[model samples]
Target: MGQRLGVDVIYTGPSTADASEQVRILEDMISRGVSAIAVAPNDAAAVTPVLIKARNAGIAVLDWDTPADESVVDYSVQQVDSTVYARHMYDLLVQNMGESGDYAVVTGGLSAENLNIWIDEGLEYAKVKYPGLTLVTQRIPSDEKQQLAYQKTLDLLKAYPNLKGILGYSTPAPIGVAQAVQEKGLQSRIAVVGVALPTDSGPYLEDGSLDVATLWDPGKLGALTVYVASELLNGRAIADGQDVPGVGRITVRGKVIVMGPPSDFTKENYKDYTF
Candidate 1:
């Protein structure tokens, strides 16, 4: 996608346990003449200085999926704003749960800013819109393994016998949660919803184990970053509402650019989407 957009992209790779190694790798990408870079920083704040150095070297920086220091990056592209996605998830859960039930949230990690913001938004909306609903627990399972999410779901089920809904933000958690629900024969009693790929959650949706999965074309987002970086490198200013060729039209509000809608994949429309 980057090459198609006429820009060269270099991966800074995943964040490591060692902060110095992370910085060294990013600086090396800049030294190698990478004009523009896009990254989903594992540590939101820790990657800021390297991005700052890149900016000092006249490189255009773009942050995606994960946020970086706003002052260091030229722009940030995300699937959607945290609060917007959260409310969307809340609405879906309410629709499936009939507006009232004991619910639980499965998040990526408690320390991850993006996941926490989404959870906060969901909590606020649920409090205001579904006062009858009670959130029994919010689980942050070890996102590294699929089994952790499955095990966490089982623990949640045992802890909250009245649980009627689950909203998961992690990629694997929703799928594993669905499996646990099906195994426990609680599919009819509890509904699940979250961000997931269609293929990953297809069987569950088809069998009515999972309610819905919110998604968007991630490759499109990556492609957009490259195109935008190319535009920046060419010294063209992108106005708030300017339309990019492959990224659809965009509207910049504050520091965040809304990429597109949360493509809700379910039994009805799952087959229509390829990604």
Candidate 2:
């Protein structure tokens, strides 16, 4: 996508979700005088000042996936409305669980702003919409690691033997939970729903371990981010309902960009999406 737009997008960050490393990376980008910097902050507050520094250096600062402080950030390219998406996860959970039963949440961690938004919204939405649903414990942090999530799911099963549904909030969380369920032959006993890539979540979906995995295309998101940044750099407005190729049409809200709807990958449709 960056190549198509003639934009040299340099993708680099801390390998281990480190905030200090993120700051160091941005500082280097600032030193190199890059035209734009798109960050999915590991820590929004920890990364905000550096983003502001980039902005003051006459570089475009955009946040993708996770958001940065809105006051200084130029644009937030989001995949979908967090509230709606969160509720949709619960909706999937309810459908798979049949009657409401004990369920729990496994998240990437407490740091990411986007994860918090989804979890908070989902928890509140679940209380009102599915009154029969019961959350067994506080949302557990998986540290965005599949092995950790798998370990956590095992613990969840031990803690709540009657657990009927599991809502995984991170890309790896559901896969990890699904693995544990699959190994335990609990597919029929437990319904797992989570945010994961189609390619990564396909096997679990096929085996009925993961009931549904939901997410938007990262390829399209990257393209849209570069496209938006390019427009701003070239002094063009990002019009509402703008048709962004590969990402479909987008809706602009002030400094925010919504990249159409999210895709829910089930066993039947998982093969339809390549990325």
The model with the greatest lDDT is 2
Q: How far is each candidate from the true structure, as Cα RMSD in Å?
A: 2.3, 1.0
Model 1 lDDT per residue over 1-275, tens place = 67666555665564433445656778888889788877676566778888888888887888887677788888887778677788999899988887877888886655456677788878888889889888886456545345777898899999889899998876777888888998998888998998788888889998878999997788778777777678778887667777777778776876677787778999888888777
Candidate 1 error regions (>4 Å): 15-25
TM-score (C-alpha, index-matched) for candidate 2 = 0.97
Q: At residue 252, what lDDT does model 2 achieve? A: 94
Off by over 4 Å in 2: none
Please report, as a residue range, the 10-residue window in candidate 2 with the lowest summed lDDT: 11-20
Native-to-model Cα distance after best TM-score fit, residue 112 in candidate 1, in Å: 2.5
Cα RMSD (Å) between model 2 and the true structure? 1.0
Candidate 2: the clashing residue pairs are none
Candidate 1: global Cα-lDDT? Answer: 0.79
